[model samples]
Target chain A: MATVALKSVKKSYGDINIIQGVDLDIQDREFVVFVGPSGCGKSTLLRMIAGLEEITAGELKIDGKVVNDVPPDARGLAMVFQSYALYPHMTVANNMGFALRLAGVPKAERDAKVKDAARILQLEPLLQRKPGQLSGGQRQRVAIGRAIVRQPKVFLFDEPLSNLDAALRVQMRIEIARLHSSLAATMIYVTHDQIEAMTMADRIVVLRSGKIEQVGTPLELYHYPANVFVAGFIGSPKMNLVPVKVQSAGADGITIVLPGGGTAMIPVQSSNAAAGSAATLGVRPENVAISADGPIAGEITVVEHLGGETLVYVNVGEGPFITVKAGGDSAANVGARVRLSLKTDEANVFDTNGAAMVPKVRKPLADLEKRGH
Target chain B: MASKAQKKIGLAVLGWVVALLVFFPLIWMALAAFKTEIDAVSSPPKVIFDPTLENFNAVFERVNYGNAVFNSIVESVGATLICLIFAAPAAYAMAFFPGRKTKDLLMWMLSTKMMPAVGVLVPMYLIFRSTGMLDTRTGLVIVYTLMNLPIVVWMLYSFFREVPKEILEAARMDGARPRQQLLLLLLPLSLPGVMSTALLSIIICWNEAFWSINLTASNAAPLTQLIASFSSPEGLFWAKLSAASLLAIAPILVFGWVTQRQLVRGLTFGAVK
Candidate 1:
C-alpha cells in the first residue's frame, strides 16, 4: 500500500480554474471519496491523481516519490473509467491480462493472474467472451477484474457504477466495498451521488468550485458539516434551513426567533456576531418529528411512501417547506394539517455565512434508540 | 398493406430494369471481343454472329498483353500499399490527436486532389525525361501514388473518426504503447473501412489512363496504355479497340464484384450509426 498526497494541486482549462489548490493526505489503505455536484472539481481532482490530467501547479506524491510528471502506467495506479472502457475486440481473459502482457510478464504468470481475478469476479464462465457479448454488469465486472490483476498501489474509480441500473448499482456497490476490504488497497472514488460517498467512503472530500469544502468521515460530514453546502449535500432530503434572527445571546446559548411566534435556544459560540443577526437554523429531515401536538402546524403538501419510512413535506407559512420522516405505517394524507416539532439536540445552527455552530455527535445505534424520538 | 406491397414490387421491377440497362454495354463489349473485324463494325449491331477468337489471337500476338497485365498489377498494387502505409498513421493522427489546424490541414490535402492533372502535365513530362524515368514502371507508380494519396488519407481519416476515442484510451490504460495501439486496437476495429479504402485506391490506380499513356510506351505500358495503343491515325479500329477495352476493364470488373459487399457495407455503416 502507498500513501497518496496532493499538495496544493491546481488545475485550469484556460483561465477558468477547475481545481483550485487542493491539499489532501490519504493514508495508506484508506478509501477516500471525492464528492461534489456537477461542475465541481471532484472528478478533475481524481484524474490529476491518476496522472490522466496535468496539474497546473504544485506537486503530487505517490509512495513517497514526487511523481508530478510520471505517466499513468508507470505510477503504480489503475483507473476504472466512468464508461468501463473495456476493449470491445478482446475476450474477457485478454482484457483482464492486457496490462501484464504489456509489461512483458511471462505468459504463465499473466494467465494465472487473470484466472485468479476471474475467480474473484465470478467471470470464469466469460473468459472467452468479448465485451459486446456480455451485459453491462458483466462488462463492469471485467473492468474491475482488469484493475485487480495489476495489483496496483491505488485504485481509482471514476463513477464506475453510474451507467448501471439502480438494482445493479447497489449490488456492484456492495461488491466494490467487499473487494476494497479484501484487497486492502487505497481507493479514491469520484462520484456526484452523495449516497455512494456516504455508504462506501472511509472519508469524503466534498469539493465546490475547485476548492475543498470539507474532508471528514461519512458520519463526521453528516453531523458536523463545515458549511451550508455540505450540510445540505451530505444528507438525504437535505437539511431544512429556516431563516432566523438571533434575538438575544447568553453564556449557555443563543436565543433565536422563528418566522412565526416560536423561539428556541441553540447552543453555540457567538463571539463573531453580536445579538440580533440573521442566520439559518439547520435541522435534518429525520430530526423533525411530525407530532400530533407541537409548536407549529402546516398542511402536508406531499407524502412519499418508501415502505420503511414516509417523508412528509409540510408547507409552513412564508418560509420554504420542511420535510419530516415518519413511520411508513403513518396514514398522513396530503392536504391534511399536521403538527411538526424539532428535536432540540438534533437541531443545528449556522451563521449568515453558512458555517455550522454546534459540536457534532456520533450516537451509537443503542444511543439513538435510548433517546426514542 | 396492399399498397405498400405493390409499391415494393414496382420498385423491384424498376431496379432490375435499370440494372440490365447498366449491364447492356459490357455485354455488347464482351460480344464484340469475340467478333470478326466486319461483324464487330456492323452498323446495325449483329446480335448473333458466327463468333471467332481471332481478335483475342490478334491481341495476344500484336502486343505483349501478358507483360502489360503484369505491369498494371505491379503499379496499382504497389501504389496502393504505399498509400496505405503513409495514410493510415497520418489519418490516425488527424482523427485522434488533432490540433487546432488539423481540419485546415485535411482540407488543404483534399484541395490538392482538385488541381487539374493537366496543369503540371508538361512540367512532369520534362522532369521525367530529364531524370530518365520516361519508360520506367517506377515513374508510373510514383505518379499513381501521388494521385491516390489525398483520397486515401481522406477515406482513412473518416473511418478512423467513426471509431470511438474511448477504445484507444482504454487501450492506453491497458498499457498499450503506440505500436500495439495501432496493431491491436485501431487496425482491428477499422478493418472494414481500411479494406474499402484499399479497394478504391487500387481501382483508381488501375484505371489511370493519362499517366499510363504519356509516361510509358512499350517497356512499362500498363493495360490502359495498351488499350490506348489500339487507336491509330489511319482508322478507328472499332473491333480491335473494343477487344482491348474489354480486356482492360475485365480485371477491375471482377475485383469490384468481389469486394462489392465490403465497399457498400463500409459506405453505409456511417449513415446509420
Candidate 2:
C-alpha cells in the first residue's frame, strides 16, 4: 500500500537550489522512473523520497502519512545504490540477514528468510562467499537480495545497472522487470539513460535543470512530446527540428514553408502564432521517407548501416542536417541526392518560442488517459 | 649487460655495509653486557674473551628490575589502550563527516606535538606536584597517552578515510545503528590499519624517555629510569650500563621483529592496488 506523494518539494544548499518545487505522485505497484541529463536533480528527488535528503519546503507522504521528518530506516523503504554497496567483509547470507538480525529476529527465521531471498535471486550457491569473491553480476544480485529480505513497501534503485557491461545490463534489465512483477512493489528508479527510462518505466518523468519537463507513459512521450526539448531528448537519432516560416493559419491547420521551397499544412493549434512569423517543424526520423516526388530534397552526407536499419544524414540547403531511418537494404549512397517526404499527420509544429503548438487531433496511443487499463 | 649486473651486486653490497654500520653500536653494547668492567673499557675493545654473567647479575642486584619491568609494561599498554578508545571515534568523525574546518583542526592537533616537551616541563611539573600526581603510574600514563594521541588520531583518520562512505550508508539502510556500524562493519574492515596503529602506539609509549625520566621516581620508574640510574657521576661503569641498556630494549626488539610484516603492510597500505 505504498503510494508516495510529494507537494512542492524543494531542496537548496544555501544560495544554490538543486531541486526547485517538484510535485509528483507515484501509485502503488507502479514502476516510475525519473530521468534526465546529469545535474537535472533526478537522483536528488529520489533521495528525498528515500528520506536521505531533507525536503526544504514541502510535505512528503508515504501511505497517507507525512514522513518528511522520518529517518530512512523508519520509512519502510529499501534502496539499491549505483555501487551496489555490499559489505565487503560479510558473506552473502549475512549481508542479506543483517536487517533481520537488527530487528531481533530469531536465527532460525532469519536463515529461512535469507535462503528464500537467495533462492529468488539465484544466489543460493554463493551464500557463504564474501562480496569480494563474487563477480560483478553476483554482487549485484546480492545487493538486491539484501533489499528483498527487508520486504519494504517501496524499492528505490539509483542506476543499479549502470556499472554492468552492455549484455549484462540488458539481462539485468529483464531480471528487474521480472522482479517487479513477482514482488508487486511500488518502485522509483533514477537514471540518465533514456533508453532504460523508455523500456522499464510504466510512467517516465523527464526532468531538466531541476524542473520536470514532462511526465507520461513511454509511447505518449515518444509520439507527443510537449516541447522542442522533450521532442529532441526522448528519441533515438533525435527528432529533426527544421526552421520554417509560417505562411498562413486557418481552420484547417497552419501552413509552413519548408527549407527546400515546399509548403505543408500541419494540423496544430496556432492561436499565438501570427502569419508570416517564424516557426519550426519537427519530424521523427522514422516518419521521414525517401521518394521520387517528395517535396524536400537533400544530398546524403553520411549513411550508417546498423544491420537491420540504416540512418541517412541529409543536408537540405543551409538548414539543419536531417536524419532518415530507412531499411537495412537502403540503396542510397553518400553524395547522392534524395527527395524527402514529410508525414504531415505525424508532424509537430512549434512557434518561435519553442513551445509546441497543440495538436488538433489526438494520437490514439499517445492519449494515456483514454487507454484501457 | 655486464655493467648492469655488476651495478646491482655493488648496490646490494653497499646496502649491507650501511646496515652493519648502523647496527655496530648495538652490537658493541651487547658484547659489553657480557664482559667485566676492565674488559668493557679496554683500549682496543675486546672482540673475543671469556664472557661472563657478572654485569647482568650486578645490574639486577643493584635495582628493583622486576618492579621497573612491570611498571613499563603496565604504563605503555594501558596508555595505548586508553588512547585508542578516545582516538578511534574522534578519527571516525573527522574522516567521514569532515566539515570545512577539519583540516585546520587536524593541523592544530599536530602543531601541539611540534612544541618541545621541555618548553612546558616546568608548568607540567608544578601541576603534577600540586595535583599529587607526581611519581605515580597514573600520572605517567596520562602524560604518555597525551604524548601519543596526535599521531594515533592522524593514522587512524587516514585509514578510516580509505573506507567508502557508501558502505556506511548501506549499513544505515540495513537498520544498523551508529554504534553497531562502528563495531560490526568499520572496525573489522580496517582491522589491519587498527592493528598497525596499535603496534606503533605501543612502541612509542614503551620507548618514551623524557617524561619517564622527569615525572617519575622510585615507585613508578620504568626501564628508562632504570637504564638512566646506571649512569651515575661517581664513575662511568660501562659494563653495567651496557647490560642495563640491553635489558631495557630486548623485549621491544623481539616484539617488533615478530610484528614487522604487519607494520610494513599497514604503513604502505593504499600505495599499491
RMSD (Cα, Å) for all candidates, in order, is 3.6, 2.3
lDDT of 1 by residue, B60-93 (tens): 8899988998999999999999999889889988
What is the C-alpha lDDT profile of model 2 across B75-140, one tens digit per residue?
A: 999999999998988898898878889999999999999999999999999999999999899999
- lDDT agreement with native, every candidate: 0.87, 0.90
Worst window of 10 by summed lDDT in candidate 2 chain A: A364-373
Residue B143 lDDT in candidate 2: 98
Off by over 4 Å in 1: A274-277, A358-373, B1-24
**lDDT tens digits by residue: candidate 2, A91-134:** 99999999999889999999999999999999999999999999
Considering only N, C-alpha and C atoms within 3 Å, which residue pairs clash in candidate 2?
Answer: none
Q: How much of the real interface does each model capture, measured as fnat?
A: 0.55, 0.68
Maximum-DockQ candidate: 2
Cα-based lDDT at residue B85, candidate 1: 88
